[model samples]
Target: MSVGLGLPIAAPEQLPTWARRADASPFSTLALLDRLVYANPEPLVTLATLVGTTERVRLQTEVLLAPLHRTALLAKQAATLDLLSGGRFTLGIGIGGRPDDYLAAGIEQRTRGRRLDDQMARMRRMWNGQPLGDEVGPVGPAPARPGGPEVLFGGFVPAVMNRVARWGDGFLGAALPPAHMDRLFRDVEAAWAKQGRAGRPRLVAQVNAALGPEETVAAARREAHAYYHPSPFADHVAEGILTTPRAVRDAVAAFRAIGADEVMLYCWAPDPEQVERMADAVF
Candidate 1:
């Protein structure tokens, strides 16, 4: 089973030791992205540095909201990162949940789904080095990989799932229920068949995990709420689905059985040492 780790680009004070321990172990990949656009210090530059220093680790954005920025600019930024990382970048994208983000960007959040679909198309064209409007032959300094890096779409809404099947290379399912995940995969496969695309859709699942003494479960729950309250699966926290390491591992196994290609463990601990301990427990 291939497993990955996801880290949030939040306050420096919020990064646990585990988040900082990029030097150890061999997980499938490391996904990094900020929840709030302006909260982090130079997100693109920081991500580039991480890619430059780390070998054999795939770098990804849990999701870089496209509607919040110009499609051309986003493509350029992603292409640069992909080039710097030797094609190690996987551009995970989505329409953001925060209305405030759109307001801050002076963009409206209406019709975000369709807008995202259009943006995806535009991004692919840009990455292919195709010039927009009235430009030269092709965009210079193409991404290290041909056709640019792989794109993973995030969100579990039915419309989002359909879009993933129609366009994205894969689906980044946020804490989805097991049964719904199965249905989503079926839809993706059906869409692929209808489009005459070969092979199955790549599915990535993210689960919140905390492993430690029983006394720590409450803290973990609070941390999870802080991070995932905006997501669809926020209610699962009370159901005891994401309270322990054992539970998280079982959930990963369950997702695998339901056709998930990879599971990215999202840890909630602010303590770096605890995060490392949890990684030891699962990885």
Candidate 2:
């Protein structure tokens, strides 16, 4: 199985250690709609440092909410990061869940789905070196990758799945249940087949996992709860999804059985050292 690490955007204090860690590949989780709010203003600089320091590890935006940001600017940032990272970049994107984010950005939350589609289309055009109408010409210093970094779409709803089938190169499902995953994979595969696409769609799922003696499992559940409780998956967690490593592993194995190509573990420890410790047990 291919392993990838998630960088904490919610906790900027952890980033320095996360960056300095030599054992794990760095994957930035860009869930914040506004860069000024959640990310350092100088993200490219941080990404460049990670690339220069690490030998085998790659850098990725675990996700950037597309609807809240301007398309052309987002394309430029992604392209620059890809160029700086020597093509070791993957553009993971999603339509964010918080309506407040769209409100703060002065974007209409009701129109976000359509906006995301248009934005994605525009981003692709910009990446292809096509001159947009007016003076907004081709982006300077093309991405190191020929076509640009791979675009991965994340979401679990039907609209999101349709978007993935139509435009995205991959699908990322967060905190998914295995049975639910089976249905999702079938839908995506069927869509791909209808479109006469040849290869299987890249499928990835992220789950919270904590490994330790039995005494620590409760603490792990609380950590996992902090993330899932206020989200759509809140009901699932209430149904006992994040209680233990065995529960998490069983869910992952079920996804693998149903053809999920990758599984990303979201570690919820307060300390980077604890995250590394958990990684050692799970990996």
Off by over 4 Å in 1: 8-23, 37-45, 213-219, 228-243
In the range 1-283, model 2's lDDT, one tens digit per residue, is: 4545555444555555665562353332322112423323234445655666555556655566777778888888888878876777777788777765677788888988899999878777788888777876786557888766777888777777777777777787775577877787888777767767768778877665555544445554664555554787664563453445566556657778888777666554435554555444445
List the candidates' TM-scores in order. Answer: 0.85, 0.81
Candidate 1 global TM-score: 0.85
How many times do residue backbones clash in model 1? 3
lDDT of 1 at 74: 79
lDDT computed for candidate 1? 0.70
Clashing pairs in 2: none
